[model samples]
Target: MRTLLDLVLPLECAGCGVPGEQWCTGCSRALYVPPVVVRPRVDPGVPCWALGTYSGPRRSGIIALKERGRRSVARPFGRALAEAVGHLRVAGEIDPPELGSLVLVCAPTRARAARARGGDPVLRCARIAAEQLAPETVLVPELLRMSTGVRDSVGLSAGQRQSNVAGRVEVVGVRRSRSDNGGARTGSCTVLLVDDVVTTGATLAESARVLKDFGVPLAGALVVAHA
Candidate 1:
């Protein structure tokens, strides 16, 4: 069915711009490489992993999904993310509590930006990745939100980015824990932050801080690419 639509509309691959396929095999292979540990300017106080650098196919696919409205490319990206998660689990980098699931918490986007883009692409990719890991994994898409007045982080310095999100990322719908132990018990679920790209890592840092304030401890963070 997609091939037929491609024939009629002549769609291009979001990664390589090759005609017919939404995401070509070569580009898919590029994202399938081993996930690597990355250090951003602002630490999120947890391990951070990225599938690839923000370049070539990875960069192109992200731009297409977020700016060009080419959502079809999300599947391959999500598959790559799932593969990274599986590898981390096998490698002992991500250890869920016994009898608990690995929970993916998508990095929040502005409601206005999400509306303009039809939806939140990061959340969409996370959802797809969670589906691939279902029964053992879950997705919490609304755990965080960007407060109003937060400016876009593009072209901002690391410090500026940090300032922009400082105290501006809010935890949503999560009740404050009454325990003095300082960590919320989320059904024994191990939480992992999910995002499409990480630049200065300010957003992730702020997100983790806010979630912590709400007593949700993050195990780590995962991204499609690191700039």
Candidate 2:
């Protein structure tokens, strides 16, 4: 019945005007066919990778996914990010364990933002990608908190960016009790931070700093796009 309804009440492609598919193949191909790798100095401690440049169709697709309620579009977007990270792996940029023991940690959104969106968008995307890349990767939601009254991260200069995120984000809900399975002594594990988009590396850098302080081995960062 639902399938029939979907066929009848056509949904235009979020990427293109093509009917049926949420995002047409052509547009999806254009989304992240060739992901970009950026190495700005601000992203210290943890290596950061953004899938696509924030321009042209990629920018439009991301805006639609974030602001226009095209939440279903996250699947393809996550795949693109995973692919980008995989590309880095092949290029010897990021090194996952031989057994591929890695955790996917998402940067937390403000309480109000989560309430407005009904859920954390980056977490949602991370889960989808983790599922698709399952067995090889594990999803860890061990980052974030309500606002620390930090200054708004927008329009800040590079130096100001460093100061703004300093000591603002904290490590809140990580379990330290050792399990039967021996991992890190603090129960802190290797983690790769995930986010939807990054303009300035301020937010990502801040999150990485907090995770490093928590004694979690900083692996890398994954995001859908860079601005």
Backbone collision tally, model 1:
0
In model 2, where do residues sit more than 4 Å from their true spots?
Answer: 1-10, 32-34, 155-161, 176-190
- What's each prediction's clash count? 0, 0
TM-score of predicted structure 1: 0.91
User: 1-227 in candidate 2: lDDT tens per residue?
Assistant: 12343355568776665776777787777655545666755765667777667765567666666666567777777777666656766787666546355578887566665667656767767777777666675555646764656665567887787687677777777665546333454254446788877777777788877766666666777777777
lDDT of 1 by residue, 1-227 (tens): 23343355667788888987788989989988778999999999999999989999999999988997677777898888888888888788987436456778988887789889878888888888887776654755578889898888889999999998889888776556455443535647778999999999999999999887777878899999999
lDDT of 1 at 222: 96
Q: What is the model-wide C-alpha lDDT for candidate 1?
A: 0.84
Alpha-carbon deviation at 70 in model 2, angstroms: 2.0
lDDT of each: 0.84, 0.67
Candidate 2 worst ten-residue window by lDDT:
1-10
Runs in model 1 lying further than 4 Å from the true structure? 1-9, 96-99, 177-184
